[model samples]
Target: MNTTELFLVAMLIVFSIPYLIWRVFRTDYWAPLVVVQIVTGVLLGPGLLGAALPEVYGAIFTPPVIASLNGVAWWAVSLFVFLAGIELDLPLAWKSRRESAVTAGFALFTPLLAGCAAAALLLLVPGWVGPKAATWQFVLGIGMACAVTALPILILLMEKMDILRQPLGQRILRYASLDDIAIWGVLAIILLDWQRVGRQVIFLVLFALACWGLRWLMQRLAESDRWYVALVWLIVVALGADWCGLHYMVGAFLAGVALDMRWFDRDKLDQLRHHVLLVLMPVFFLSTGLRTNWTLGGATVFLAAALLLAASVGGKLLGIHLAARVQRWQPGEASLVGWLLQTKALIEIIFANVLLDKGVITSGTFTALLLMAVASTMLTVPLVTPMLKRNPGLIGRSG
Candidate 1:
């Protein structure tokens, strides 16, 4: 009836419904609870639940309730992305620079080319491109979405599949980590507001200085002290970035990457990540799904999703397979690595959301990319299960 009750109602639904479906149906093998939660967010959004029960949807998700939920969702994703940034093991990547470069480059670029082609076609349609987007921005935004790998989700899926600590899993993480940097860089390009370009330039200069000081302070602190400092740092950097037109998530990532992972205990860092996902990320998923639309109609959105998924999966596999040939990886390794690299749940959604906020892509395109991301993620475990099962020795091989 009131905002608090309604907010609680919304919270209860987001947390409960997805878990119930995931647990009751035993969807863990195919769709993890996080994926299920993302789907649930869509189902509860204007396109589905709202379309079916407009009054109820409006009543529950009133302005105040929506605002409150959004506050949680924003901080949830901010922290999650921050953690993703901190987890990047760039040192490991540097150790295997040659293999990492050729593979990561191809893995990012080929799909980028393919996705641009797909985006070019979508430009021929009207509803898919946002009003504020120039053609180049739209194309590049969609392409980056196609190329993104959800490092955090990839880790989760690999852990579930029991390969996360293995040599293969660690190697896969290196590839994803490099792409994570490129994804944000491209997003900055897409979001570059010429009017704000001066401000952005200033932000970069100051941010560099801040990072130096931040690094020095972090090195001197105890791990316990570092945790609180990191939070303060996350907020300040995120605000500064948003002020400069780079977006707060970019700031969040920069905030984390400025510090070393060795500063925190590895297991505690992992637990903090785990806690963020369990406690807060469901709100982000629901917030993301609420932004989805089928303005051109549901069938059109679904069809677009299918096309994008094909481009994403095909380009990723094609690129990895090519890289494998160049690097002389063993048989079946490309498929295993490519499939794992295609994980795109949280990061892809976050990328699409940023594009949508900046009006670089329309809701129709966002919905399509969101669907593509979920489908690509769901396909990973199912497709890789048989390969890992049959190969037996594929768990940890030197790359």
Candidate 2:
């Protein structure tokens, strides 16, 4: 069996799991569907099925095939970010910038700062040294991981809840967007220190300037008679950010902010999102699942996972509450935003994978973080919805 055939088989299984779950249960339990796909993928990978059906599974789980699938996943995420950019509304965020900034601040940067503080403190713990030890650098790495928010998933959740155009939804989305930009800047700094300090600093400044230039270009294109030209410029800027050592996501986000400044078209953005979600985004999620290794035999691994889960949940809520107080957000709204934003998804996982690839975090640590992210997200989804409904005047209010 070749990669294609194996992938086809994986795809078949991935597609069928939902139906199987639907048949077994009367509810739309996407989580179980996701779990089955991951479990099945692992079973069919070199771990299990390859050990049993050597020839058939080996061909599909080959290094080249895995790399190819990962590459596809990366591309899918890139598209996801691009569409995320398209969906943002600059005017709305601008109109509500102060409140949104407070929300976004608590939602992202507070946890990041807290994570950094924790990491800095954890560095002194005896014997926690070397490759996997809690060093200052590693602490910084963890902080970065904690600070990230996957806007696509947040937006999707908002849309599904039918609050996307509502006040709370707009406010949450706005803050999340603002937080995304700020976090990218932080990531650029981390990469600079991790990659090349001197060049990274210089490049970061240049990247900021380039973002300004790109914004101008996008705005011009948006206003021009040639609507298609805006998209072309967006692509150029998106790739250009990668060339300049900045994440392509930064470029995509800038493109979105620029688009928001001009014409905010929900229909067009939705169209792009629809295609990306059905086709590419699932590949990205499936690949994320494939990368996750849930098999754990050690108490240490379990402890680490548990600690991370507790920290992730506690940290976000605490951070958001503190930030809200600092920024003078209403108590009800603050609590709502804090609880909801704790949920992690693709962004944190993908970035952590990048960190692992860079040797900033070990594979074992990355796996732990991925689990922490998924667990936090799962817990939040069910919990946040009901909490928000309970506080209609705060988080549930429209306009």
Candidate 3:
């Protein structure tokens, strides 16, 4: 068949297989449809599908088709990341600064240190670090990947657990919000190019001035007009960021961060998020899958994934438990909070993708990080459910 037909066929597979598995197996108890979609993307990637059925994979995912899918995926993820940035409730986090700072600081730093250690170990061997990466870049990049919490996915999980509006949930959001800001700041640092430092500096200076003007204009415009202007802003900033040597996603996030969530209707923002996920993000997931490479061997990749996951999960629990002691929280609260914060679904994937694009991590390392993210996300609900069941009062505890 032609390229368009093949692209359509690929899309059909992308949507269908994950939905069927999600629906038929009742995996929502453990793996949400989003998780299933991510897992399916890996299974369909070159390492699996290309290896298993090269002819079929090649026929469907030809160069032209892959290029088309990538165009869609880029826009999809840029928008998704932009929305995530807008969802940062910094004002609320500031209102509860001490607890949020202690938790977010510990939660972000501990895993980061652990993941850096793991990255150092990976450096002992070849094939893990990207060609262009400095030692510090690879280690810090991997460290940040391990530390990332998927704020959007965390919101979804909290809603699923029926605690999104609860006191506990609000607290978690505050912690995640602060970490989300730090995550992007660290990303910009990692993406900093000495050769293009002048360009990046100019981009930031112009961006700051433009952001102020955009905010003034947004406040005056109707909400309907704000949406249109926001898209234009997303495109322009993303272009500038990419041109200046930082990833377009960095610009996309900055674009969203410049705007206040209150500027738009809350329900409309939520609906926009939901609709973007439903319509666009699956393509991003599939495109992510297509990038997976296991050339270093499956066993090596899985071992690295296990190492990252251990560092991520273990460090998160330890950090949160320490926070619990400091904050004088009741027993089991740390475990609940830690497991929830350890979630690395969309954000980690995005982080890894940026690292991969910037040559800070190899495709092999990307595969490992992808595996780690999927495993970390899939562990959240099942583990958290039983904890909540045992201590229903935990949800009501505001601190």
Candidate 4:
């Protein structure tokens, strides 16, 4: 068949398989459709499907078809990341400064340190760190991957559980929002290219000026115009960031961050996020799957994934428990919040993809991180549901 036919066949597979599994198996209790989609992406990747059926994989995922899919995937993720940035409610976080600082700080650092130690151990083995990475870069990159909260996915799960607008849910959003800022900041540090520093500086300066003018203009435009302008702004900033060697994802986040959420209608913004996930992100997931590798052996990769999952889940809970103690939170609050905060899906995958693109982590390492992210996200709702049921009052706790 021709490239277009093959591309449609691939797209059909991407959208259909995951939806069937989610529906037929009723996996929504333990695994949401999004989580199922991610797992399916891994299973459909070269390491699994290609290894099992090389000719079929090659026939459907021809070079041109893959390129087309990648183009779609890139835009999907950029828009997703952009929406996540716009969702950040930093002012609300700052209002409860002491509590937010303590919770966000611990929630971020504990997993980070644990993941770094895990990364340090991986460095003792071969094939985990990428060829272009320095020891510190690889370690920090891996550590940060572990610490990602997938604020977008977290928002989805909270909405599913009917807590997104609850006091507890809002609190969780605050913690995740602060961590989101730090996550991107650290990514910039890791991606910093000394040779491109001047270009990056210029990009930032121009970006700042552009943001000021954009904000002024956005304030006067109708909400409808703001949406169109935001897209144009998203593309321009993303292009500039890529040119400066910081990665377009960073640019996308910055573009959204510069805009006020108040400028857009809240319901419309939510719908846009939902529509992006439904129509576009599946392509990104399939593209992500294509990048996974098990050259280090499936057992080894699974082992690494298990180790990272333990670090991410354990460290997040430990940190939140400590914060709970300090802040005198309600009895079940820390456990519930920690489990929710540890959720990682799209953001972790994006973080690993950036690391892989920059050669800070090997494809094998990316595969493991991907697996860990899937597992971490899957565990969130199941664990949090029971905790919420047993202590329903926790949902209303403001602090």
How well does each candidate superpose onto the true structure, as a TM-score? 0.91, 0.80, 0.88, 0.90
TM-score of 4: 0.90
lDDT of 3: 0.86
Candidate 4, run of 10 with poorest lDDT: 288-297
Order candidates by TM-score, high to low: 1, 4, 3, 2
CA lDDT scores, all candidates in order: 0.85, 0.63, 0.86, 0.87
Clashes of 4: 0
- In candidate 3, stretches whose alpha carbon ends up further than 4 angstroms from where it belongs are 124-134, 165-167, 187-191, 296-300, 353-364, 393-399
Using lDDT as the measure, the top candidate is 4
Evaluation by lDDT, superior candidate among 2 and 3: 3
* Ranked candidates (lDDT, high to low): 4, 3, 1, 2
Q: Compose the digit string of candidate 2's lDDT tens values, residues 317-352.
A: 787777767777665766677666764666777677
In candidate 2, how many Å is residue 44 off? 5.9
| Candidate 1 similarity to native, TM-score | 0.91
